[model samples]
Target chain A: MSETNPPIKIELVSDPMYLCGARELVSCIAHRIGFDDMECSKIALAVDEAMCNVIRHGYERATDKPIWVTITPLSESDESFGGIEIVIEDEAKQIEPTAIKGRELEDIRPGGLGVHIIREVMDSVVFEKRETVGMRLTMQKRADRPEEAPRISSRSSCPIPAERRVS
Target chain B: MRERPIAARAGGFPLSNDNFIDIEHPESGVCVVIPRHDVDMSRSPILRSAIKDEMGSGLSKMIVDLGDVQYMDSSGLATLVEAMRGAKNANVSLYLASMNAKVRAIFEIAKLDAFFSIVDSRDEALSA
Candidate 1:
């Protein structure tokens, strides 16, 4: 992630076909941010999973719904950490930010692992509503990221929605 | 992924889209399923259907040869997880072979690395 370059914003429909191209974009961006192939692929997969959630649950698989993804690079001077940040905005019906989650690994089932993947790959994940409608997902990864990212199950440990935020 | 013998052309046949899956049985009672291209959300359904169809057909053991896949997302993982459950019930042994570092990491992140029987090469999978 770099501050010198402008952030990349992507707008597309909820259709799943476009996700492959989106993943390639994020992986390339992560590569430019100095991450290795493994990390880059993880970042791309995480973003892909997030988009799948928006398309699956938020949009109910409606191919025509809109989803916006903004990827901003962070500099080392900002917080003594340099990495990548991605914000996903969905125009689907807004739900309680806390309600967004995946199934527990302990249960061992399919269909709810996307949320787990996003939290496990990224450094920090925050959710805030887009004022009146839709939801915004803000996920950031630090350059000195964890070799093993933390799992999220306790909702209390998560950051709450800010009084004011952007989509 | 190490270079290993792929029954790529031996008794190969497509299940759904001809490009998605190539089924081959190199030896008796062993079936190898090779999923082509990146196994993302869009491609996952095809892979899932192919696996489901194979499981429905009686087989002693199955190996999902993933040497050709460069990438896989949660949807791909979900498809395999579902296959795992189906395999367990059907008493059909399953093994995942030839995953590159990148695809294997996706499994590790989901904490499923411990659950599946994964091998490094296709020959190992076939002989196991």
Candidate 2:
């Protein structure tokens, strides 16, 4: 099996306005890939949250910092079983990867839901530290296809488990 | 005659002069904050500051009109959560109104629909 689809790459300043552009791009790409309106929005939202985290936490809101994003379609031969892979990189302070979890939902406050939102929308989320500096966050979401219906998880149908639901 | 400053500032994050947000005083002790753009990480700070300022000014009632917000991310959601917390601490009541389908879906996914007081219209929010 061979993977050959060229990934779409976008580089922008660590500004919120640019995140809107990125969201629009991701929504269009997801729609082009046959995702429904709701699904496309979810994917775009996940990407938006990830980029926001990089800017606010990773880059500490340094508008001059550069944020790089890559969107690649996972090949059918891969384990993702046909999905999209989004990689976001930033040159900001690196923190413990385990600290990325969203706050307990039961607490009902704000300021920490970004990480949780990413986890809820994407199938897999991974955070890695770069060799010298910076950090990389990778997220993947499998498409919903008729043939692979069972494999697709709907947030509405498969609610976040009681144990995993953060306060 | 002197003109009154319409928006308050929170810490270093001032209410941007840009068209991204609009703050309105619909009634006494009630402020309505509207985001004319997508609520994402980039724009959340502005919204947060605006809400904080409103809370600080002793506005015990708030209604966030999402009528113009077509899209929102977790960053945006977090701002709302923070505002809600601030409102509680100050003994204020925060209400959200006119959320579009997409924005509403994000809240549903996060299971925050149960946590926040969301109404269908600005009128309902005001009355609530």
Enumerate the candidates' DockQ scores in order.
Answer: 0.75, 0.58
- TM-score for predicted model 1 compared with the true structure: 0.84
**Which segments of model 1 are wrong by more than 4 Å?**
A1-3, A145-167, B1-18
Model 1 lDDT tens row, A24-87: 7887677666666677788888899999988998899898998999988776663445778899
lDDT of candidate 2 over A1-167, digit per residue (tens): 22346788988899776787888787766655446667778888888888888887787778889888898766555444476788898888988787778888777766677788888898889998877788889988876664442233223232332322599
> What is the overall TM-score of model 2 with all chains considered together?
0.79
> What do the candidate models score in CA lDDT, each in turn?
0.79, 0.76
- The C-alpha stretches of model 2 lying farther than 4 A from their native spots are A1-4, A76-81, A147-167, B1-17, B27-29, B56-60
Rate residue B36 of model 2 by lDDT: 79
Give the per-residue lDDT digits (tens) of candidate 1, residues B79-126. Answer: 999999999998888999999888999899888999999999889987
Candidate 1 retains true contacts at a fraction of: 0.91
What local lDDT does model 2 show for residue B21?
68
Q: What does DockQ come to for candidate 2?
A: 0.58
